[model samples]
Target: MGPPAPGDADDGTGQRTGAVIVVAGVALFATALLAGAALAPDVGAAGDDASGTLVGSHGGGAGLHERGSVYLLDGREIAWRAGDTDSYFDVTKLDNGSVMAGFMQSGYDECGPYESPCAHTGFRIIDPNPDSGADPEITHEYSFPVRSEKNSEVHDVELLDSGEFLVTDMDRERIFTVRGDEITWQWNASQRYDAPEDPTRTDWLHINDVDVIGEDRYLVSVRNAHQLVVVARGEGVVEVINEGDPESTRGDPTLLRQQHNPQWLGNDSVLVADSHNDRIVELERGADGEWTVAWEIYAAEGVNFNWPRDADRLANGNTLITDSLNKRVVEVNRSGETVWSYNTPEVPYEAERLPEGETVGGTSYADGGGDTTTIGEGRDVPVLSFLLVIVQTAVQTPFWFTEVHVAVTLVSLVAVLVGLGSIIRARVRARR
Candidate 1:
């Protein structure tokens, strides 16, 4: 009722008010600190944050598309992995246990000024042993050059026995052999097919695979052209196996649409992944010069295949299929029974079995142990660090103000008020 003055000796309410103010200030300071820590940027481990262990899908069901890490299976057990997974096109284990993988990344450019504008398309040979930790090491890397407006993304890279690198350049529609930084032998698709008005505008052919079949002969898959063309090393397109409209069906089985990975089976027979048709067809050339399907495998109830991309015939007469959209790699016997299978995190482009005696610790560098060197982990969002520093400064400013100026000012104000109240009380008592 406006009766309690500053010197209210009757109630002692002034002391209680000061105590509440101090408690509230402390609570606010503690809350600010906790919030700052909670909002700090996360800094994870170095050397490829994308790698991890492969986990099984729920219920272990077949054909269930679940995301997991990429791995190589040896009798249902993981033999080795880069400990990281990527949207890799072709992953092959060499005789020396080194792994070569071809992959693409969007909006990335690693080319120099004079070089072609690369669209983050490259291959890397991963060394699992590096006298370091378990993390794999990248020993060699090659980025495809983009000379035109078209993307220079490559689909397959084969380390040839002749010490040459055979790669498929989809953007240019060419198969070129690289030997020591030079294009030794090149085959242009435009030489055989009509060149687009804008070489950069058309992925016209979409040449996916280039397999060196024999002396001066290469088997290529022209997906958009809907044909398997055999091109001679020096000569042009020597043979067109399935040259026709992709929409129309041909031979005993239908034609291949958007197909990939045309592998040559001996005796003039070819095995190909008829991607859009959802089947693997093995074609054999008859004496009459007509191509006929010798054997074919289609998706069934349990052994389902969705957009199968790559099919390789193994030595034991089994086919290894990379079921792309379904997120699994399966090996089926001649009877089409699922003999072995492995799941992948993303759409698997191609998977191949390594030669025998190649295991996780089978590398020559394995005896060097893991390397202990630490590379600086790159920050995902650099601006977050700056923002955090600003917040930290703001939080500390209050504490500094309280300790250096506010605390002194409050103490002085309290003393002055108390002295004034004492004087007023003395005056009132004297007046009484």
Candidate 2:
């Protein structure tokens, strides 16, 4: 054509221009990632600010499992860890300096009816010798078998003065007590909810937590149903919070979406870790006998709560929280200000502070809270979402680098690539 275009081949001018465009695009994208993370609010100082020993249960599933353990932190340092199983959840330190931990492990010889190398889930008594700094001895274990380790784990266990152990069983969807080797008592959830033909085949009702709120009364957390039920020893179904039809998925999930540990404050109040909702809610029972949110905290340390799995109302009027995806345990005041915090290397299910222990009837939320909504609420970009899944399979990413950040970086990079392609195509056409 008439004297070739400007960047056609000015002594490698087209190649130089193309290289600059590509390089600039990459630089911009990387810059966005860094800047986005920098803007996201980080944790408060480090974990050492708080005193006393804090015990947390490390659960598997998201990342490299099988390395799960029940770890104890004395002040800022990790004093001891016991992980003889694939995952551990719901730990309680007894008065005898021993910790009773509920656990799940794979490849068990005692698989009941299932084949060998199946999953075994139950509670183990671990003598926590923190000073030794080694995996302590597992004194005793009470476990049974299941097919796979998907949702068949024993999520909770509580010891009574009567030499009985209460447990929440996901395998059979029931709250049961085991004395020695005998199942002393059990309340099957099938009585209230729609039952599947085979409970082991599917995770029908994810009954995650149970607490001995009263003398013979139990507070149960039905996770998938998004409701809590109180069952007395003799009474089948005394009362149901968030009441809904048993045939369906149940009540208004917007109230408590797939929640985890629920701490019963008293007869009329409870504090829950609203997991999928990404918040901690303190619900008060109204005079009309209905539950409503009295106080809620959606975020702390600037970053929003991501899939928070556990929360406890402390005696000192503070709330201990387990932000799972964020991989940290935080203690916040009624105003939602973080008082103390501990960052874990991987995801932890729950944590309980020592001394006062898990006492009953916690204080109510005097004042409401700050930050009514969560930061980076939902995923904003499709490409970034897909890439994150691939990246996460290899390494765990930071929680604060949220969906909004990804959208901006991806859009900017795509625009640059489009411009680069147009310029390269023009240069090729000019060469002819």
Candidate 3:
């Protein structure tokens, strides 16, 4: 195949393909990396209405690739495994340098792969360099209690400065918080939204991601409701912002299109992962509850993005987005120029670009629940849907170049290659 575009390849300039291969070979030589060291066995077709799982090849030993790596912008690198996951979805860097991840826990009676079936839910916090040989920790195991044994999964986790966390339980239609191991606050859609008197007649609100902007302000995504909502944190949720006017005769709700993960960029503007339509929209509150779309990244035509799940508005005015199904992470500047990129061997959910220019990301897979034929450590013991949160730092340094840096690297490499070609050509001419 022809070389990928600058925006498409990990090192946009394509100068480091040989370097990457060489590094991979050297690492393999130094360490016999385990392939799928702790992956779930391949189950049959998933059940109906179950939370879908992303599947990958069962190769080597564990059936899928379980290795993860992180890189710094200066070529320094580190690698780690997500400690056997089915799928690694959302990823974030906390104040303490530990990474928080959200993903599904497999093995439910309801649905199979890709089906919206009932499934167990959980989140993990992976320490890049845990106490030496000690395995990484999966903090706070959770299940979306209530509503039969089906498609209950936590999509993302919002960390508060106060050391609390907000979790988005999709099938349960609620957002809840945990502080010091206690359920401190909660919001149920049936009570928070304007639901019909007969709950049976009410539509299910598929709440996806939650973001805490202030001590009392939160932004939530309701997919079916097709809107991003801002609510207060208290005994009862109070509406502080609604992006659209919901077409309800009761005039109690606001209508909006598919939006998720509203993150506050500043006090007035916020960035949204508009997944359904494949875009990133910046909304700023205007008069009253009305919001204006200030900026957006359209995933149409020649655009480099496809199905962006979550995005971070970086301090440098650039954006790092998880191109979910594409299994890649993209860094786009304010001018929409893709400055850097990273491709994954599996599916991706969320990604975080650290201040040091390293990226930590997550991945997931289907076909969980090991059988007798499947043998591996951490297998049979719930492989947690192959969700990996990766931190890619070293390999990404070449792409963070300013125009001058890129120019210098490109000129140096090309000059050396051309000089060698000239020498070989001269030797051939002399022999003739």
lDDT of 3 by residue, 1-432 (tens): 685554443332233444444454444433322322223222111112211111111111132123322221211122444535444555666667566666654445544333445445646565655458555555555543323322344667867766777888765577888875687778877765566554322336667777765566777777666666666876455553453444441221322345555566655566767665456666565545455555666532223244457777765566766655445556666656566655444445565555432122111111122111111111111221112211111122211122233334345556556555545554544444
Model 2 residue 211 CA deviation (Å) reads 0.2
Each prediction's TM-score against the native? 0.60, 0.83, 0.56
Q: In candidate 2, which residue pairs clash?
A: none
Question: Each candidate: what lDDT?
Answer: 0.57, 0.78, 0.49
Tens-digit lDDT track for model 1 on 202-271?
6677787777777777788888777888888788888888755434412122557678887776645777
Ranking by TM-score: 2, 1, 3
By lDDT, highest first, what's the ranking? 2, 1, 3
Return whichever of 1 and 2 wins on lDDT: 2
Best by lDDT: 2
Q: Give the local distance difference test score of model 2.
A: 0.78
Candidate 2: where is the Cα deviation over 4 Å? Answer: 1-29, 44-48, 59-64, 131-134, 245-249, 366-395, 405-432
